[model samples]
Structures are given as C-alpha cells and as structure tokens.
Target: MFAEEQNPTTAVAGRRLSDQQAVAQFRQVVSRVEPVAERFCKQETADRENFDCDIQIVVDTSMEGRNAYQTYNDAGKPVVGFTIPMIADARNPDELAFVLGHEMGHHIGQHSHKQQQQAVAGALILGALTAYGQASATAANPYRYTGNDQRDMQNSIELGAGVGQMAYSQTYELESDVIGTAITKAAGYDPVKGARFFARPEGKRTANGRLSFWGTHPPDEKRLATVLATIEGIEVSGGISRR
Candidate 1:
C-alpha cells in the first residue's frame, strides 16, 4: 500500500540483531524517548483538566508476539508497554522510538475516552432505530413477539457499537502518526525510518500463531503520507500543530 519512496525494505532490512543486542537497543531507545514523550504529553495536555500525563512504560515478557500498546492502570495512569517479541522484532531503535511515541499519542488524543463515548452513542442510536422498527412491525401484526425481535435488536446494538468504535480508527491512527513523528524527531530518531517498520510484507499473524503488529497497526499509504506531512510541518514550523 506504499509507493517506492515509502518501501519497507531499506537501511535495516534483513538485518536481525542478537537477543542481547535487541534488548540493549530497546532500553536505549526507551531511555531517550520516554522522557521526551512524557514532556511532550504534558505540554500538549497542559490546558486540559485531570489529563493524565504520567506515562508509565512497561514490558510484557510473557507476550510471545510482536505488539505494543497503551493502556491505563488501576489508578488511571497511562501505561505504554512493549512485548518482548515486539522489542526483539524491531529492526532498529528508531522503530521502537516511533512505536512508543505513537502509543503516547493515543493518550494525548484521549482516544479511549472518545471511543467509549462514541460506542455508547452508536449503541443508543441503533437500538432506538431497531426498537422503532419492531414497534412498527408489532403495530402491523400484533402476533409478532417471536423472541427474534429482541435478539436482532441486541445484535444491531452490538454491531453499531463496533462500527462506532471503528469509525474513527483510521483517523486516530493518522493523528497518532502525526504526533509520533514529532516525538520521534524530538527524541533524535528519524520518524520516516521508524515508520518503515509498518510497511512489511507479512500476514496479520506471526509464526507462533499470534496476531502480529500489523494486525493492529495496519499499514496503508495514508499512514506514510501523514508521517511525511507531519515531518514537513515540523521542519517548516519547528513544532507540531495542535490537533
């Protein structure tokens, strides 16, 4: 889904680091990027109230696949994590830096909060529409309480919630890339090079039969375009624009 300029193979392709090398590189990247990301997060969320900018970085050694994520703890602090495989799978430190920054961007964008709201709104709208249809049908035929109506309405509501959650998935990803590019650059990594980690030619799952990184962070031309555009803006304006 990328053009020649955005090809996946370059610089670090086909180069696999040893386990020791990989772990060391991951730690080095985290040391540099984590502080930068936290500072950036605070700066971006300064005007908002109760915005959690205390980002905690963690590693899930039990996870066997290549994946990273952002989640909240029991106390609502943002936690960004990278699996062991995810760290080992990185071709270079730039990839790890970019991935961490992207996860931080999710928090900066308040995506989880917005997604929950959207899902509720979508579920309510679809449930109401289904209820209206059922009522109309019952009005026409008073004998239409076959238990299928409730099941169908429930299914519609679930589908609507899923649709709502996904409606802004692409946009959210692009926004993260925009923020990630700026963060990666500020952390002394090349955002474009880091983004190339996504343009791999592989299935959605890894060899161990678990979902791969691409399964969640699907690559497309738009993602590359966004990173490039963000880099351009940073170079021209010397900072990231407010999203």
Candidate 2:
C-alpha cells in the first residue's frame, strides 16, 4: 500500500489501532517471539556468543515501503525495522507477528552474510574470466580493441555480483517462510491464518509472473504452499500448542 494514501489508524485484532498502538502491538509480538528466535539460534549457529540472539524492533514512521526487514545495527545487533506503511497495512496481530517472524528468519538463517559471500565470490570469479578473455583478445590482435577493457570488466563484475545475489534469493525467501510459520505457531498464533496475509489480492497480483526468476522473493502462491506444508508438519510433530 502507498504510504501517502494509507490511513493512520488501522484495524488490528478486530479493533482500531493507531500508529502508536500498532507499534506497541509490534513490540508485544516481538517479545513473544524472542524465545523462539533464541531456540533457532541455539539449533543453527555454533558461535552463539557472538551472535546477538536478541532482536530489537524499530518502528520507522518516516519509511516509505509497506514492508519490514532485518539488518544489523551499528552495534552489530540484529534489528528489525517495520515501516509505518507496513504497520498500517496489517489487519491483525497475527499478520504483524508473521511479518516480524519472517524478518527474524532472515537473520536466523544468516542469509545476509551468506548472500554477500556468494556475491563476492561470483564477482572475483567473473572478474578473472573477463580479464583473461580481454588478454586473449589483445594477444590475438593488439589493434583489435573493441572498447574500454576496464569499463567492460567492471560491468561484467557487477553483472556477476547481481547474479550471485539472486542465485539463492528465492530459496532464502522460501526458507524464511518455513521458519516464520514455525515461529508464528510457536508464538501461539495460527500459522495458516498468518499465511493468508500473503494471499491477499494485491499480493496475488504482484506474484503473477512478474520477473519471477529475477525477483528476490518467491511467488506468493509458492510461499503459501510452503507455509501450509510447514504448518502441517509442525502439527504432526506437536511442535506448537495452539492457543
């Protein structure tokens, strides 16, 4: 939803929650999900000491996007930022919880660090290949210069980096969905209902084969299916006690 057109007061849990109220609700959800995040950290990471399993939620009212994301703060701590529009768009606490869980999943999965490593590796490999090709071309004919070799090499490296970044982008998104489902369930919310937020009309339209391969996120339908399957598995294992 567009930030300019969104209502400042939105409904959450069948009642009107202003922006301030929404922020409070977000904090409450985060507090509930912290134990789940800690459990994931213990299970996934070996260096638990350096990993700041504590998650801090920041409500950015000045932000434009109807989205939330996870990143490291200046203090090297995991922080999730919820844009005002995203908060305004949520229909209930469960939706907010799902979004928060997804962002936390990115951190839990160490996707940011992994993606950066992949991009750097891809750039180094591709840059070397480009330089080798340039040298070979120059050796074949010193005067057969196509254009600026430096510029061409830079372009190739950038392209390779982009490809590397997108290589596992869809996979990361799907993995986040799975983790987020588990999180929502563990937090005593209905993961199935939380997944419905992605099945909204706007989400469906955006996922309709628009740059399917290049986009960072998987299609909403695919995400919904993964969430459903994950929730089913969790239920079978009695992983989460429904509230």
How many clashes in each candidate? 0, 0
Off by over 4 Å in 1: 4-14, 206-211
Candidate 2, residues 114-136, lDDT tens digits: the string is 99999998898899999999999
Candidate 2 residue 194 C-alpha distance from true site, Å: 1.2
Instruction: Encode model 1's per-residue lDDT on 1-243: one tens digit a residue.
Output: 265534554434646777678888888998999889889888888899877777898988877777899889998888988888778888778888999899999989998889898899889999999999989998999986658987999999998898888889888888898899999999999999898777666578778777677877887788888899888888898887645
Model 2 ranges off by over 4 Å:
1-16, 46-49, 201-218, 238-243
TM-score of each: 0.92, 0.81
Alpha-carbon deviation at 241 in model 1, angstroms: 3.0
Evaluated with lDDT, which candidate comes out highest? 1
lDDT of 1 at 51: 76
What is residue 151's positional error in candidate 2, in angstroms?
A: 0.5
> What is each predicted model's overall lDDT from 0 to 1?
0.84, 0.73
Residue 155 lDDT in candidate 2: 95
